[model samples]
Target: MKKLLKYSAFGLGGLVGLMLIVVAIVAATFNPNDYKQQIIDLVQAKKSRTLKLDGDIKLAFWPKIGANLGKVSLSEHKGSAEFAAVDSVKVSLALLPLLKKELIVDTVYVDGVRANIVKYKDGTTNFDDLLSKDEEESQTIKFDIDGVNVTNSAANYSDEGTGAKYSISKLNLKSGHVALAEPIDLETDFTVTANQPAVAANAKLKGNFLVDPATKHFVAKGLDASIKGDLLGGKDVDITASGDIDAKPDTKEFLINSLKLAATGQFSGAKLTIDLSAPELKALKDEVTSKEAKVSLVQEKGSDTFKANLVLADIKGSPKALQSSGITGDISGVQGKRTISGKFSSPFIGNLENLIFDLPKLAGNLDIKDPALPNGGVKGNFNLTLHADAKQELVDSKFDLKVDSTQLNGDVAVASFTKPNIKFNLNADTLDLNKLLGTSSAANPAEKTAANQKPADLSALKNLLLDGKIKIGNLIYQKYRLSGLNVGIKADGTKLALTGLNVKLDDSQIKGNLAISQFAKPLYTFDIDIDRLDVDRYVTANTGATPAATKTSDKPLDLSALKALNADGSLRIGSLKYGKTKASNIRIDLKADGQKLSLNPLAAKVDDSQINASIGISRFSDPIYSFNVNIDKLDADKYITKSDPNSKSPAAKSTGDTPIDLSALKKLNASGEAKIGWLKLANVKTENVSIGLKAADGIATVSPFSANLYQGNMS
Candidate 1:
C-alpha cells in the first residue's frame, strides 16, 4: 500500500507542475487585445450594433483571475451614434471557485461610465431590444461579490411623450459583500437634475440593507441621507434624514424606528427651519399607527419671527381616514414690536373621503404685549369648535372668548377661498374702544391737525363680502357711553350697509340706518332719529362768570376731505336741550357733494315760536356761506343769557364798543335774509321786522333794514 500511495502522489505533483507551466506560457504569449476585432465583429453580427475598443485589454493571473478593459463604447442598434461608453472597468474572480462551477467575485471597479436612455413617444424604451426575454429557460447560478466600486458615472433619461427629462451626474457608489439574503453596506453620492419642475440637487446616502428577492422583503438599518439644493424659487435648501426601515410586501407589514428629519430653507421670502421626530411607526395592511410624533418650525423675515411646536400622540389612521388621541401645540411670534403667544390643545379627526377635518374641543390661552396698549395689551382664554371642508373650501367655527373684563361669544363661517364670503354673529358684555386702542376719550374735539385732514382710505372695503350682527350690553366711545347697542352689518363688493342700528345714551333712544357706496369716493345715505337728547350731558359745562370774548383760530380750515365726501341724510329729534335753550320736534335735512353742502328745511319749535331756516356753504377751501331765516314770534329773554351782577371783567358789563374783531367775517363771502313777525330788544317790542345783509371782497353792506316801531317804519 505504501508503494502505491507514493506513485500516486508523484504523478499528481507532476500533473500540477505541468499545468502551471502551461498557464505561464499562455499568459506571456497570448494578447487579449489582438482578439478585439474578432469580438467586435461577433457583437455586430449577433446584436446588430457597433462596438469600439479604443484602449488596451489587459489580464492578470496568480492571486486572482482578472480582466481590465479601457475606453470601450457601444453604439445604438444599427446606428453609428454611441449609446453607452465606459473609460475603464476591472473585474476579478476567484480561480479555485470557478473549478467547482461556483462564481465568486473579489471586487469590481468601474469608472467614467455614461449612458443616455430614452422613452419614445410610443412608450418604447431605447434599450428595449437588450431587455427582450430569452425564449428558452436558462440555468441559475449562485454568485457572490465581495465588493463593488463605481466612480464618475452619469445617466440621462427623457420621456418624449411627457416632455420630461432627468439627469444624474458625478455618481459614485461603493458597496461591501453583496449576496442573496445577506446584509450589505452601501454609500453613494450623486447630483440629480430635473427639467419638469426645474430642480437641481446634490445628495449623499449611507445605509446597511438586507433584501430577499423571492419573498420581496427588505430591511434598512442606520440609514442616513442628506440633500442640498436650490429647490425653493432658487433659494438654498438643506435637508437631513435618518431612520431604520423594514418592509415585507408578502405580509403587508412595514415599520420605521427612530425616524428623525431636519430641514432649513428659504420659503416665500422667509427663512424657515423645521425639525420632526417619531419614536416608532407601523403599518399593517390598511392600518397605520404611530406612538408619538413631534414637529417644530421657526420662521424669520426682517424683524418678524414666528415659532411653533406641536406634539401628537396615539396617531391611528388609514389613507382615507385619520384620528389622533390629542394634539398639543404652542405658537409665539414677534410682529411690529409686539409679542403674541398662544398655547392650545385639541383632539383631531380627519376624513379624506368627505374632505373634512374637525377639531371638536380646541382650547387655548393667549397673551399679547404692546407698549402702545393702555394696560400692556390683553391676556385671554378661549374655547372653540371648528370644522373644515376642503372640497367646499369652507370653515366654520364657534368660540367663547374672555379677555380682560369682557366676555364674547361668536359663531363665524367663511366659504370660497378665492372670493371669501363671511358670516358672523357676535355677542359681548362690554367693550371700551378708548381703552382697547390705547386712546383717550378726554381729547379735545376742537384740536385739529394736518394729519387729520387727510382723506380717509376706504380702498379695503371695495371687495369685501360680509354679513354680520353684533350685540353688546354697553359700549364706550369718546365721551359717549352707549348701552343696548345692536348693529347689523352687510357688505358686498363696493357697497356696505349698516341696518337696524339701535342704541341708547344720556337718556336718549337712538336708531339709525346707514349705507355707503363707491368707497374710494364714498357716498353715504342715512336716516337717524333720537327720542330725547340732553345735549348738556355730553358737552363740557362752563363755570363761574363768562368771558367777554372768546379766542378763535385765524388759520383757514382744511376741507380737502370734502372733495371725496358725498352724503344725503335726515336727522330728527323729538326733544333737544342745550344750556337754557330747549327745542321740540327738530328736523334737519342735509345734502353734501364734492365741495358743496346744504342743510335745508331746518324746522323747530322753541317755546311756542316756529322757526324755519336754511344754510348753504360752497368753495370749501375759501368758504362762502348763505342763510335764510324766518320766525313767527320771538321772545329774546328766553334764549339770551342773563348778565352776572357780580362780574370781574369791566368789558363784561360795558355798554360801549366791545372792539369785536370782524376779520374772520371779512374773509368769508356771505349773504343772508331775515324776517321776524316780532322782535324784542332791550325789553322793548317791535313788529313786522325785516333785514338784509351782503358781504364780499372784504366789504360789508346792510340795506333794507326796516321795522314797524311804535306804528312807524325806518329804512
Candidate 2:
C-alpha cells in the first residue's frame, strides 16, 4: 500500500511538473507582438478604423496567466487623428480558477488611457463604427471580473453641432467583483471640464451598486460624492452629497433614498451655505415627486446675516405644471435675528411666459426691525397676506403692522394690470412723513425738470380706475404737525377726484375737495375751506422766500404756468393773517383757460370794512391786467399813519421819477367799473364814489370818475 501511494504521489508531481513545463514552453514560444498585425487587420475589417501597436506585447506564466500590452492606439475612420490610445494595459487570470472553468481574473489594470470623441452635425461620432455591433453576432459568452483598476485616464467629447466640449482628465477608477448580475463596489476620482455650460471641477465618487444587465435596472447603496469647482459664472463652490439611488431604465423611473447634500459657495461677494436632505425622491421623465425635505440656507456679508429654513412636501411635475399641482411648503427665516415665518402655496399655477408667479399666495408673520426710524430701530410685528392671479391679471394684498406706538392697516387690490382697476384702504395711528421722506428735501429745478419731462413715447391711459381712502391720526410733514388727516380719492382714465380731504393744523382745520379732468391737457377744479390760516407762518415753514419790500421790475411776469393751466377753483377763508394785514370771511373764485384768466368777485372783510374786487389778465407773454375794486367804510387813517404816534413827520425830499413801462399796456384790453360808499384818508372823507376805467392798445382812460366829497358830489 505505501509503494502504491508513493507511485501515485510521484505521478501527481510529474503531472504538475509537466503542466509547468508546458506553460513555460507556451510563454517562451508565444509572440504576442507577432499577432499585433493580425489584431490590427481584424479590427480594421470589423471597425473600419486603423489600429497601431507601437510598443511590445508580452505574456507571463507561473504565478499568473497574464498579458501586458504597451502603447496601443486606434485611429479615427479615414482620419489620421487617434480616437483612443493607451500607454499600457495588464490583464491577469488565476490559472487554477481558469482550469476549474471559473475564469476568475486577478486584476485588469489599465493606465494612461485617453480617448478623443467627436460628434458631428450628421449624427455620427468618431467612435460610432467601433461601438456598432453586427446583428448576426451572438452574445453567448459570460464572464466575471474580480477587480479592475484604471489610472491616469482621460476622455474628451466634442459636439460640433452645439459647439460644446467636455473632457475628463486625471481619472482614477477602482471596481471590485464586477459581474453581469451581481453587486459591485466602485470608487472614482476625476477632473472634468465642460465648455457648453463652462464648468471646471474635481469630483470623487464612492458607491456600492447592483445592476441587472437584462432589464438595465440599477440600485446604488451608500453612495457618496464630492465636487469642488468654479460654477455659475466663476463662483467657487464646494459640494458634498450622500444618498441611495434606484433606477429602472425600462420604465424611466428613478428614486433617491435619504439624500443629504451640503454646499458652500461665494456669489457676488457674499458667502453662501446650503444644507438639504430628503428622505425619498422619485422621478419619471418630466414628473417628479418628493417627500418632505429639509433645506437650510445662510448668507452673510460683512455684518449682515440671513438664514432660512424650508420644508417641502408633495412636489411634482415640471416648473410650468407645478402651479397647478399645488405645492405646499413652510418657510421661515431670520435676517439679523428678525424672525419671519410663512406658509407658501400655489393652487393654480400658470405658464411663466404670461404670469408673474407660479404660486402667488403668501401669508406670513414678520417681526422685523425698521432701520429708518429715529431710535436704534423700530421694532414691528406684522401679518401680511398677498395673492395674485396672473391669468386673471389681478393682485390682492393686505397687511397689518404694529410698531411701538404706531399701528397701520392696509388692504389693496388691483383688478387688472393692463387696464388697472385698483382699490385700496389704509389706516394709520401716526406717521412721520418727514421720517419716511428721509431727509430728502424738494428736488432742485434740474431734477424736477428731469422728472417732469414727458416720455418720448406715451402710453394711452385706457380704462384706468382707482378708488382709495387713507386716514392717519397724526402726520408730521416737513415742519408742520397735523392730525386727524383723511383723504379719499377716485380716478378714472379721463378724470380724477379728491372727494374729501381734511386735516387739522395747529389751531385751524382745513377741508377741501378737488377734481381734475382732461388728462391730455389737465383742468382742475377745487373748493377749499379753512377756519383760519396764518399765511406768513405757512410761507416761512414751507418755503425760505419771505415777502420783501423792493422795487417792482418793469419786466413782465412769467405767467406761462397760468397760460398752460386750465382750471376753475374757489377758495374761502374764515380768517387770514398775512404779514401785518388781517382779513376775515375771504372768498375768491379763480378761472384760467389758455392766456385768459379771471378772478371775479373776490370779496373779503378787513378791519370791519367790506372789499370786493374783480381782476382779469390776458396775453401771457406781456400780460395786461384789468381790475375793479369796491370798498365800504375803509379807515384809511389807520393804515396811513406811522406806528409811533409821538414821531414827527419828516420834511419832504425831492426823489427821482420812476418811469413806468407802458409796454405791457399795449397788450392789454381791459374795462372795469368801481364804486365806494365811504372812504377817509388824511382827514379827507369821501362818500358815494364811482369810477369807470378802460385800457387798450397802450391807451388808458378814466371816464365819469366821480366821488361825493364832504356831502358834495364831484366829477
Candidate 3:
C-alpha cells in the first residue's frame, strides 16, 4: 500500500510539473504581437473605431497570469484626434480562482493614460456611442478586484455650447480590494484647470466606501477632502471638508451625517476664515431636510466675528415653486453678544398643483449694538411680522422699533412691489442729524474714501415712493436747532407734499406747508406764519457768517436759480427786526412764474407810521422794475438825522464832475405812482402829496406833482 501511495503522489507531482512547464513554454514562445492585427480588426468591427498598437504586447506566467500592453491608442470614429491613449497597462489575474468561477484580480496598474472628451452644441458627447449598447448586448457583468493603482493620467473636456474647457493632470489614484458587499479604501490626487473661470486647483481625497453592485447602494465613511486654488481672478483659497455619506438608489435618498468644513481665503485684500458643522442633512425624492447647522466667520482686517445657528424642516418643491413650499425654519445669529432670531413658514409645500406661494407667517426680532456708531455705540431692538394673502400677495405687515430714545410703530400694505401704502407714527426725544450722517472719525478709511467718491448713477430713486409722519422733540440739523418739530410727508412719482409742519426755532414758532411738483417743470408753493423773528440773529446763527455793514463792490447777482423757480407763497409775520429796520404786523404775498416775479403788496407798521408798497420785475436777462408806495404819517426827520446823535453831518463837499452810470438805467424801465398823507422834516411839514413818475431811454418825467406845505399849495 505504501508503494502504491508513493507512486500515486509521484504521478500527481509530475502532472503539476508538466502544467508549470507548459505555462512557461507558452509565456516564452508565444508572441501576443502576432494577433495584434486581428485584435484591432475585431475592435474596429465591434466599436467602429480605429485601434493602434505602437509598441509590443507581452504575457507573464510566474506569480500570476498577467498581460502588459504598451503604447495603445483608440481613434475617434470620424475625427483624426485619438479618443484614448495609454503608455502602458498591466493586468494580473489569479489563475486558480477563475476555474472556480471567481474572478480574483491580483492588481491592475495603468500609467500615462490620456483621454479627450468633447460635448457638442446639441448636447451629444464624443463618448455617447461608447456608452450606448443594443438590448442583446446589455448584460450584467460582475468582477472582483484586489487592488488598483493609476499614475500620471490626464483627461481634457470641452463643451462647445458653454465654451468651457477643463483639464486634469498628474492624477494618481490608489484603491484597496473592491467587491460587491465589502468595504474599500480609495485615495486620489489631481490638479484641475478650468478655462471658463481661468482658475487652477489641486485636490486630494481619501475615504473608505461600502458598495453593493447589484443594488447600486453606496456608503462612505471617514471621508476627507482638501483643495487649494486661486479663485475669482486672484483670490487664494484653501478648503477642507470631512463627512460621512449614505445613498440608496431604489428609494432615491441621500444623507450626509456629521459634516464639517473649514475655509480660509484672501478676498479683496482681506483675510477671511469660515468654519461650518452640521449634524445631519438628508434629501429624498420629494424633500430635503436638515436638523441643525452652525457657522462661524471671522475677518481679520475688519475685526469682525459672526456666528449663526440654522435649522430647517422638510422642504420640498420644484426649483421655481420653492418659494411656495411648506418649509419651516429658524435662524439665529450673534455678533458680539447681540442676537437676532428669524422664523419663516409657508403653506404650499406638498401640494404639487399650487403655484401660489402663500407665506403664512414670517416673524423676527433683532437687537444690535455696534461700537462704530457716532455716540460711541448705538443700541436698538425691533420686531417685524409679515403675512401674505391667499393669492400670495403681501398685504399686512407690522413693524415696531425702539432705538435709543426713538420709537416707531407702523403698518404697511402693498398693491405690488412697485407701490406701497404705509401708515406710521415716529417719535424721537433727540436726534442729531450730524450723527446720523455718519460723520464719526471711527469710519474705515476705505469706506470713507468710497463715500467721498461721486456716485455714477441716481436712477434707483426714480421709482421711489415715501409716505409717513415724523415728529421729534429736539433736533439739531447742521447749524440749525429745532424743537417740537412735526411734519407729515407724502411723495409719489409726480409730486411731494408736506403738511402740518410745526417747529420752534430761536424762541419763536413757525408753521408752514409746502408742495413741490416735478411732473413737467419744477414748481413749488408755500404758506408760512411766524409769531416773531429776529432775521439778523437767525441768519448769523445758521450761516456762521457775519453780515457786512456796507457794500465794497458791485457784482452781478446769480439769479439762475430764481430763473428756474416757479413759486407762489404768502408770509405773515407778527414782528420782524432786520438790520436797522424794525417792523410789526407785516404781511407779504409773492409770486414767481419763470422769469417774472411780483410782490402784490408788502405792508408793515414802523413805530407810529404805516407803509405799503408793491413791486414787479420782468425780463430776467435785462431786468425792468416798477414800484408804487403809500405812506401815512411818516416822520422824515428821523430818517434824515445821522445814526450817531452826538455827531453832526459834515458840510457839503464838492469835487470834480462824477459821471453817472447810465448803463444800469438803460437796462431798467420804470413807471410808478405814490401818495403821502403827511411828511415832516424838523418843523417843516407837507401833506396831501401826489406824484407820478416815468423813466425810459435814460429820460425822467414827472406830471401833476403837487404838495401842500406851510399852509400853501406848490406845484
Candidate 4:
C-alpha cells in the first residue's frame, strides 16, 4: 500500500507541473489583442452593432484568471451612434476557488464608463437587442467579491413617450466585500439631472448594505445621505438624512430605526429650514407603527420669521387605515413689531384607501402682540373639527375662536380642488377694527388722490368661486361704529356680488348691494340707502387757523382711472348733515359710461329750501363740467363757516381781493346756470337770483347775473 501511495503522489505532482508549464506557455505566446477584430466581427454579426476596441486587450493566468480592457465602445443597434463606452476596466478571479465550485473575485476597477439608453414611443429600448432573453431557469451561483471601485461614470436615459430626459454624471462608487445576503460597505457620489421638471442635484451616500435578489430583502445600516440641488421650481436646497432600514416588499414588511432628516432651502429670498426625526418605525401588510416622531421648521425673511414644531406618538396604521395617539404642535410668527404664537393638539385618524382624514377635536390657544394694536394686542383660544377627502377633493372645517372680548364661529367647506367652489358661514359677536387697526381721522382729499394713484391688481380674483355669509353683532372701523351687520358675498369667475349688506351706524340704518364684473376692466353697479347719516360726526373738526400754503396747488388731477370707470349707482340718504348744513331726503343718481359721467338727478331739501341739480362730466382729464341748478329758497349763511367769537385768536378777516387761487378752475371747463327764488348772503337778502357761468380754457365770465333786491332789479 505504501508503494501504491508514493506512485499516486508522484503522478499527481507531475500533472500539476505540466499544467503550470502549459499555463506559462499560453501566457507567453497567446495575444488577446490579436482576437479583438474577431470579437468585434462576431458581435456585429450577432447583435448588428459596431464594437470598437481602441486599446489593446490583456490577460493573465498565473495567480489568477484576469483581463484588462481599455477604451472600448459599442454602437447603437444597427446604427453608428455610440450606445455605451468604457475607458478602462480590470477584473480577476481566484483560480483555486473553482475547485470547490466557489467563485471569488478580486477588487474590480472600472473608470470612465458611459451609456445612453432610450425608450421609444413604441416601448422599445435602444439596447433591446443587446439584452439576452433566457426562458429556462438557471441554478443559483453563490459568489463573493473582494471589492469594487468605479469612477467617472455616466448614464443618460430618455423616454420619447413622455418626453422626459434624465442623466447621471460624474458618478463614483467604492465598495468593500460584496456578497449576496451579507453586509457590504458602499459609498457613492453622483450628480443627476432631469429635464421633465428641470431638476439638478449632487448627492452622496455611504452605508453598510445587504441585499438578496432571491428573497427580495434589503437592509441598510448606518445609512447617511446628502443632496444639494436646485429644485422645486428653481429653489436651492440642501438635504441630509441618516437612518437604519430593512425592507421585504415580497412579505410587505418594513422597518426604519433612528431616522433623521434635515433640509435647508431658499424660496423667493426667504430662508427655510426643516428637521424631522423618528425613533423607530415598523410596517407590515396589516399593521404599521412608529414610536415617536417629531418635525420642526423655521422660515425667515428680513424682519419676518416663522417657526413651527410638531410631535406624534404611538402612530399605528394599516394599508387601509391609520391612527395616531395624538399630534401636538406649536407655531409662532413674527413680522416687525407684530407677533403671533399658538399651540395646538389633536388626535388623528385616517382611511387611506378612501383618501379621507379627520381631526375630531383640535384645540389651540393663540397669543398676539403688537405695539400699534390697542391694549398691545390680544390672546385667544380656538377649537376646530376638520375633515378632508382627497378622492373627493373636499374639505370641511368648523371652528370656534375667541379673542379678547370677541367671539367668532365659522364653518368653511371647499369642493373640487380644480376650479374650487368654496362656501362659508361666519358669525361674530364683535369685531373691533378700531382696536385692531387703531382709530384715525378721515383722509384728506390729497391723501385720497394719492391712494387712487396706486394700481389695483385683481388678477387673482379672475377664477374665484365663493359663496359666504358673515354676521357681526357689532363692528367698529376707525371712528365708524356699526351694529347688526350682516353681509352676503357671492363670486363666480370674474364676477362678484355683495348682497344683503345691512348695518346700523349710530342712529342710521344702511342697506346696500354692490356687484363687480370683468375684474380686469371692472364694471361696478351698486344701490345704497341710508336712513340718516351725519358726515360731520365722523369728520374731525378743523378748529385751528388755516396755515399759509407753502407750495402752489397747480398739480394736475389724475382722473384717468375715473374716466375708464364703468359704473351705475344710486345713493339715497333720508337725513344727512355736513358741518352746520343739514339736508333731508337727499338722492343722487350716478352713471359712468366710459367717456362720460352724469349725476342726472341730484335732489335735496335743506330746512325750508328745496334744491334740484344735474351735473355732467364729459372730459375727466382737464375736466369739462356742465350743471343746472334750481332752488326754491336758500339761506347761504347756513352753508358758510362761522367764526368762534370766544377764541383768543380768530381767523384773520379777509380784505378786498383776497387772493383766490383760480388755477384749479383753469383746467375745469364748465358751463352752469343757477336760479334761486330767494337767497340770503351775510346780512343781505334777495327775492330772486339768477346766475350763469361760462369758463373754458383758462377763461371765466359771469353772464346774466341778475337778482331782485331792495325793491329793485340789480344786474
Per-residue lDDT over 155-274 for candidate 4, one digit per residue giving the tens place of the 0 to 100 score? 999999999999999999999998878889999999999987777999999999988897899999999999899876547899999999998876767799999999998888999999
For residues 27-135, write the lDDT of model 2, one tens digit per residue: 7898888888899899888777889999998888868778888899989897778999999999987676666556677779999999998999998987776664767
lDDT of 1 at 13: 95
Q: What lDDT would each prediction earn against the true structure?
A: 0.86, 0.77, 0.72, 0.88
Q: Quote the lDDT for 52 in model 2.
A: 93
lDDT of 1 by residue, 651-704 (tens): 557665767668766576789988999988778788888888898877878777
Better of 1 and 2 by lDDT: 1
Better of 1 and 4 by TM-score: 4
* TM-score for each predicted model, relative to the true structure: 0.56, 0.48, 0.47, 0.61
> What would the TM-score be for candidate 4 when compared with the true structure?
0.61
Number of the top lDDT candidate: 4
Name the 10 consecutive residues with the lowest summed lDDT in model 2. 450-459
Displacement of the residue 380 alpha carbon in candidate 3, Å: 2.4
Model 1 weakest 10-residue run by lDDT: 448-457
* Candidate 3 lDDT trough over 10 residues, lowest sum: 449-458
In candidate 1, position 609 carries an lDDT of 85
Query: Local error of candidate 4 at 289, Å?
Result: 2.7
Tell me each candidate's RMSD, in Å, in order: 14.9, 17.5, 15.5, 10.0
Which candidate gets the maximum TM-score versus the true structure?
4
For model 4 the local lDDT of residue 180 reads 76
Steric clash pairs (candidate 2): 323-349
lDDT of 1: 0.86
Runs in model 2 lying further than 4 Å from the true structure:
1-373, 376-381, 390-394, 402-405, 440-463, 541-552, 641-671, 695-700
